[model samples]
Target chain A: MIRIFDIAAKDLMQILRDRKTFLFLLIMPIAFTFLFGFAFGGFSKGVSDPRLPVAIINQDGGDLSLRLVNLLENSEVITITQDAAKTLADYEKLLTKGNLAGILIIPTGYTDALLTGSLPPLSLEANITQTAGTTIQSEILAAANRLTSAVQTALIVGQTSSAFGPAFEQALSAWDNPPIRIESTSAVVQTGPKVSSQVAALAQTSPAMMLQFAIAGLLTCGAVIVNERKTRSLQRLLTTATRRSHILLGHYLAIFVLLFAQFLVLMTFGQLFLKVDYFRQPAATLLVAVASSLCIAALGLLIGVFAKNEEQAIAFSLIPMFLFSGLGGAWTPLEYTSATFQAIGHVTPVAWAMDGFKNITVRLLGFESVLVPCAALAGYAVLFFLLAAWRFRRVSE
Target chain B: MLQNAIEVKNLHKAFGDLKAVDGVSFEVAQGEIFSLLGPNGAGKTTTISMLSCLLRPDEGDALVMGHSIKDDQMGVKSVLGVVPQEIALYNDLSARENLTFWGKMYGLRGPALRSRVDEVLEIIGLTERAKDRVGKYSGGMKRRVNIGVALLHKPQVIYMDEPTVGIDPQSRRNILDSVVALKNQGMTVLYTTHYMEEAQELSDHIAIMDIGKVIAYGTNAELVKIVGQMDRITLTINAESGRVLEAWKKVQGVKQVTAQDGTLTVLADDSNQVLPRLFETSALNGVRITTVAIQEPNLEAVFLHLTGKALRD
Candidate 1:
């Protein structure tokens, strides 16, 4: 047996001396919170109005073609830029640089084709560089196709006006009616529901998970452990009365404290700057934060034990953490993805944490909804810690 | 019936097929500076590691301060301090902080820990640079801190494994002085080194080891006596002294004679009897000797005579 506090004190002082480690533990998490909170948090649940940038190069110098371009400019989804000098080359350049989403080319023969009821295939070029850009391009193409069909139908109806005026007028009025119907239905799909909040608390709680993974990948804990081993400081430590358990527990405790501080900073920034209602149930949030920190700390220990050097540890920790966070919906909320992908996210602790936070902040669910994830995270913590301890003992022996 | 600080009997440890320490046995009395002198890969480290309880011997038992390393590992570890060949101090921290951290591991705390840190810094003569980061320290300074960490626990027996391997002459002297100071305070030191001079100067009882076995073990004088009967003499004379060498070989107890480039070397049982005859023969043969020297038996000579190889080789 050895005094754990003594070891903890030393570990803390070492962390304080390393400036890079200090920034990783405390600063990086807050920066990530702001980054993901503003970028992806709003789109987690379905964005009702997305301002997608679009560009239109109108080659047809006709009144009808000009009217159609105006319609695209007025839509909420499309922020149309009109550049008469813009060519296919210029549009492609913009797409490569990520400055343009999709290009709309109204060919010179479009008006004549519509008049003669012989529609040429309108070229709707999409920037396939990113997934979001592709989705926007598809949506804009669909809306434009609908508008063209409406115009063709009107032209056909007007040509047959002399034969049946009253019947054709009724038909034209019916066709003039908007075909798309949007019905807002609030179906509360709560696994475990709470009465205090109308809006699902789970939706708001999802953003906090980005905070969790960012903190876990911080360089201090595992990097320091690997550094000690490489420098043979650990061998010197073994010569003393300090048990292996003391050294491991000391690092574990430091990671826990550092991650907890990171969680608070992220939550505070979330509530104040982003106006995210993460603190609706303070107790539930705190429970999730503490459990997540323990899980991440255990992960850090596993990295430290398995890695032969500091560089390897840092690489090993960051790569898996980044992948898991991205796949688990911490990088982009799991809600927007397919159900299969969401299920895959459950394998990651970050996904479990996101689920727990979503229950509290989005679904307004009680502690019951978070029980499974919290328990799973705790289980991971224990398993990782045991493995780390076993590895540490083996190396020392 | 002498009390021993450390005792190992028939110690054999095998890493797969290679026998690192094969049937090695030795004992060190209390308050004596004993050295295990061997070349690299000769199982000196393995033997010390097992005695320190950092490793377990496959087929032997070691008693460190009357505690069996196999049954009572914690007991052995509690009393033993190891200064490994590598510098193991933390590079990110200050020298003072590193000592304090190590001191805490030994159950020292608060003012006691602080004072001990100060004392160790003073002892290692690094008090002025205590606040500087260890990464900025020279190789010797790092080594001193490494030794300081081992001494923080104040163990009964300290194990130093080649502590002066790559250090300058000045740092090597400081380390040697520190070891002597600790021994004077009644600390039993098991110092291992390939440097014969270090072993001869510091070890009260020296165990000359090779190929995982102790070839010779005793006081320096006792071991030196093995080669004391043989006399080695060298004579530098004028050019072309072939006839002088032929006459010197005929002398009584002069076992071998070799001559090269105006120099003659002779090995004999008694120099006193051979010198008179050698002088007369050289004079009669008209070989004027400029220098004549007789070699005395030392650790280097004893090592060379026992193994047929120099200690440094």
Candidate 2:
């Protein structure tokens, strides 16, 4: 065991001497985290009541069409665009440029259709590519439905009163002020405190970027192994009383400990300075960090063992760092991707690590909720370690 | 009963159709300096590698301190210290750091490890600069630390493979002297080098190897005796006197004459008596002799006699 520690200590000492390693291990991860977070509006201090910008084009010029626009104007989730687009083509430009989420157009005969107990076909042009845009579309549909119900009730009241225009208008006014209402009866349930969308973005970006760069920093660990082989220290060690397991275990331990320390420092920075809830459940967060570090370190060892030179080691590490991090939702939230993409992303260990972290930071779940992700990470660690050990033995032979 | 520090019999290793080491065998007694002398690609490093448990021989085994290298590798490794042909020290680490790390691998701990590290620092003459990183040291200083790492455990047998290669003359001299000092202190050493001078100056037993075979093995004088009682005479002639080599071959009692770079070397019996004839032949051929020197038989001549090629060839 002392032999194992000796090898690890020597390697760590070598890595610490390199300034680039410090940059990768701690500096780059934090910088990227803050950069992504601020770019995505995660640093905003106020409550992030994200309102979707939409346009209402009232082609109908009637009281009923005007009433629909008024109702949409009062919605808290949708902000009506003042730019009255003249055509559907005009609305498409706004949607494409991301300046407008959707457009509601009321036809010219909308008021007459309501009086005759038939509905006019209102056209809705909306971009549903994002969740905010989808929510705006649903809110527009709900407001339109409410106006139709009020018009139908007024038509029925006008028929009973033996009056038409004035009686229907009075009925519409009365329907707007409802005589009956429903109230909530069930007990309130607090599923942990909810954070604003801005805070949530910070939570996602901080851990995702931290995990991504942490894996990248493992290239230094792999380079250490290659350097030792080039210097012939590995062959010299083989001639000592130390066994093959000692050298492998020593390198693996060094990579794991170094990455775990990096993760802790970054997570602490997120919690204290950036106001991210990484430490809401400290033990659970640590469990995820350890398991993730173990898996990534084992992967680094596998890269080191198989690579024949420093160039090969760097290439091996970089290829996987980009593939796994980019494909595994480390650059963006998995929820922002397609379902097919999210399923594919889960195949990478990074996704599971991100999931474990999100469970604590975003979901505000306790230790029990993080077990599945931690176990998956442990499984990956075991698999990577076994493969690395096999390759190491073959190389030694 | 006395036991040899290492014993091997008919060791063979092959790479594809090439036999890197073939049917080679030798022994090193306790407390003696044994040298394997050969040119590059002569399998000196391969033989040392097998004995140190870094490579397993295909057909045979070696016993290090009476432990089999094949069955008990750890046992052999515990008693063996190998200084590879390359400088294997970590340059980013201090001299003391490198020693301390290797000492632990050799199973030294606590005060034992500390004292051993200090002792190794002193032995390599780097005690004052032990704290400085090895990369900051001169090439010769790095070479000293490389050897120091091998000596930390005080193993029964130490393998030094061309430790002086690619270093300054002073550093090479320091390492050569240290090998002699180690032998004087009753430690067994198995040294390998292509430099015939190092072998002649330090080895108690010298094995001349070529093409993976031990062409000759014995003490320096004993090996020299194999070439018979012939003496060597060297003459430096003018560049235009190259044809003097053929003339000297015809001289009385001269067996062979070869010329290289305006110098003529003649092997003959009773060379002192042949000097007058040699001068007569040179004068006849209009070859102006600039210098003359005579030497008795040595390893170089033995290798030339056995392989019909110079040692460096």
Candidate 3:
């Protein structure tokens, strides 16, 4: 046990002495957390609001056509342009320069169709030059489709009900009433109790984010081990009373400590500045952090054992870590992705960590809720440590 | 019992089809510097590695301080120190920290560890630079710290494997002085080197190894005695030396002779007999001899006589 303590101490000392390790384990994570959370967070939330800039060229001089333009302008989605000289060709040139998303050309006979109930097929032209322009044009067409559906439904309702008849008869009473009265009622069902914006923000910046932050440090741990091996420092230790297990255990413990410290820093930041509810259930959060760190540390050891050198270790560790973080909802919520990808992500330890962290922060769960992920992480630690020990012994021998 | 600090009997180690150390055996007495001298790929490293308990011998009994390296490996390891060929000190750590960490590994702690670290730092003459990180150190300083780590535990037997491989001349001399100092303090050493001069300078007992076997093993004086009877004499004759060279070639036991630039260089197994005979031949030939010098044999000459190849080759 004293030997183990000595080994662990030496490992910690080496990590503390290394400036790169210190920076990665402590500083890099904090920087990434702020960089990713603010930059991408706003973009992700803004995607839900479908706002598009559209130029409408109305050649018709009728009240019905003018009313349609007012209806489009009144909706929160479309921002109508009022430049009359902007022809279709001019609009195309503006779109090429990224000045316009699309153009809406309302032909001369649009109001005649509405008033006489002899509607011609109205064309909604858009700039389909770029993919994004085409997508925006499709969105505008979809909005126009919604308006047409509403008009058709109102005309049928007015034909059947005498109360709204004259207004519709003045509009379109020749149309037959639909067999079914499709009474559309808009009901706002609450998904759950409304969480505070701060709590939701804290949930977004939970321990899983801390774990993702810790993974860069874990890669540094791999580089450290590989560097030691390449430089023959580990070989020198083998000549001492230190066994292969001691070296591996020492490094593993060192990385775990560094990662744990990083998690603590994130938690502290969350509690103080972000107002995260960690104190309400500290044990659960701590367990999640500890388990996640162990898993990542083991992953680092595995990479160190297999990689031929430090460069290979860094490159190899990045792929799995980035992939796992992406799949496990570190970059974005898994619910926003396809169900199949979410199921595939569940196989990764990051998925388990994210699940455990969400249970702790969002569900207000206890340690029992995170027992499985904790056990799985522990099992990974044991397996990786054993493999690293075996490899170290073989290589040294 | 001669009080052998390290004993190996018929050690056999093989890597697949290659016999790394083939049935070799030797012992180093307490407080002696024993050397394994060989060229590259000569199995000196494999032998020392096994005795150091870094590698397991396929067939052998290695007893370090009366502990079997095969069975009681932990005990063997506890009493042994190893200074590797490559400088193994951590670059990120200070010299003092490296020593302390190694000392702690040997179960030393508190004041004892601190004092030992201080003593080693002073011994290596790096006390002033002890606080500086090893990465900032020169090659010589790093080499000193590497030896300091091995000495931290004060083990009975220390193995130095090519410790002066790439250091400067001054640092190599310093390392040699440190080895001598350790031996004077009664520390047994197993030193391996390819340089014959280093072996002759430091080792009390030298085992000349080649191709996974010790071809010859003895004291420096004893090993040199193999070719001690045979010596070369070079004669500088002021008069026409070609005549003297012709006369010297005809003389019996004069294996070879060459005269160039008014000098005669002779190769003979018996210098005493050849010298007198050459004088007589020169007198009869009327060749005037200017200077005659006899060269004493060194380890290089001894190695050449034994293996028919130069030490460096």
Candidate 4:
């Protein structure tokens, strides 16, 4: 056991001594995270209006319909983009172009139907599968609830008071500053102009890049085994009291420590500057971090064992990094991809790690949400470790 | 009954159709220096590798300190220290760090590991530059660190595979002296080299190998006796000895005559009886012998006598 730690410590020191490790370890991830975030319309914090854009088709030209439009315009969640001359087809095209987050269709008699308490259904055209769609749906639901509360309160007051319109206005205004309000930062932001991206938030990209670069940065750690073989140190090590298992576990532990440290640094960066709230469910985030590190480190070991030289080591690590990151939704959200691709993405351990992290930061779930993802990551880690062990033996032979 | 520090029985290893280490065997008494002398592809490294547990033998086994290499590899390994043919130390790590890490692998820890590392640094004469990265070191300095790592654990037996191959004479001398020092401390040393002089100078027992087989195995004096009553003469001629070679073969007391690099090497039953005949022959061929030196039979002659070729060939 002491020998294992010594090997790991030695490997870590060797890797850390090279200054180039920092480029992928921290610098590239930070630069690319912010770069991709802005390019894909992920962040909109300091804009004139950070709210998501929505196009309104108000066929109901009544007083209630106008008031409802005003209510939606005043929402902090989404902005109203209405064109008096544009038809429904124009609004649909705007929504498809991603200039609008969604389209709101209020039918001609919506005001009278709602005033009569019929609670007629309103049509909302948006991608229910994406984060922006979920945000839009939540905001619209909250606004409709406010109006229903106002109407219900006014009806109860009208049974006794003759000034029902004034009562309704007062009740609607009461909702602006509702008691027991929860202030939450939605991970979705949209601009009215067409964007070639559905870049959701740092909450998604930060962890994704964290997983991706953790593998990319392994260009060094994964080469330790190959370097030892090239330098004949591994053969020298075998002559010591240390066993093959000792060498395997020791290297595995080192790679894990490095990857976990990278994850923590990137996670802290997301929490501090990107408002990703990794610490909101700190335990769940840590669980994912540990499991991901385990899986990635095992992958690093497998690469090191199979690679014949440093060049092969680079290819082994980089190729898998692309495969896992692309297939696992590390480059983009699984929701943005086809359902078949999304289903296939879960075949990679990265998808589970992403799910574990996004469940906390994006879905606003608790520790329980990360348990299955953690288990899946662990399963991948075990599989990779066994393969590495097998390859370690073969290479030594 | 007395047991040798290391025992071997028909150890063999092969790579495809080529036998790297053929059926070979030898033993070393406690506190004695055993040398495996051979040319480059003579399987010295492969034999040492099997004994050190880096390679498993295909046919036989060795016992290090009463532990069977085939059955108890870790046990054999625990009692042995190996310095490979190459400089196997991590260049990125300081000498001290490399020694310290390898020390821990041998199961030393805490203050013991540090002190052992310091002691090894002093032993290898690298204490001053112990903290510098080995990558910045000269080849000789790197070789010393390689030796130092093996000594950090102070195992019962040590295996050094041509530790002085690519270093300066001064560093080579220092390493040779360190091997003697380790022997003086009651440690068994298994040294491998292709240089006949190094084996003659340091070995208590010498094993001469050619093509994966030990052709000769004995002490310096015992092996030299194999070419008994025989003497080697190296005579440099002003001209190539190709013309005089047939004349020398016909001379009395001349056993074998071979020439290389404008020099004539003759193995004779007696140099006293053969020198005058060789000169008479050289005069007949108009080949002037510029310088002549007569040498008693050594390991080099023994290898030549047994294999009909020079040890360095």
Q: Tens digit of lDDT per residue, candidate 2, span A355-375?
A: 788767765556876788889
Which order, best to worst by DockQ? Answer: 4, 2, 3, 1
Error of 4 at B40 (Å): 1.0
Worst 10 residues of 1 chain A by lDDT: A183-192
Q: Which stretches of candidate 2 lie over 4 Å from their true place?
A: A45-196, A366-368, B233-252, B257-266, B270-295
Please give, as one word, the docking class of candidate 3: acceptable
Which residue pairs in candidate 2 have backbone atoms (N, alpha carbon, C) closer than 3 angstroms, thus clashing? none
Local accuracy of candidate 4 as per-residue lDDT tens digits, B214-267: 989999999999988589998998886788888898999998888766778889
Residue A318, candidate 1: Cα error in Å is 1.7
Candidate 2's displacement at residue A148, Å, is: 36
Model 4: residues with Cα > 4 Å off, grouped in runs: A46-199, A326-328, A340-348, A366-376, B235-244, B259-264, B282-293
CAPRI band for model 4: medium
Candidate 3 global lDDT? 0.72
Which interface RMSD values do the candidates have, in the order shown?
A: 1.6, 0.9, 1.6, 0.9
**Candidate 4 global TM-score:** 0.78
**Residue-pair clashes, model 4:** 0
Off-target runs (Cα >4 Å) in candidate 3 are A39-202, A205-208, B232-295
lDDT of 1 by residue, B217-299 (tens): 89998988877656767788874767677777787878667665556767678788888888878788887778888876666
Best by DockQ: 4
- Pairs clashing within candidate 3: none
Better of 1 and 2 by lDDT: 2
Tell me the tens digit of each residue's lDDT in model 1 across A233-344: 7876776667778888888887777677767776776666555566877888888888888988888878887888878887877886777777776765554554367568
Model 2 CA lDDT for position B237: 76
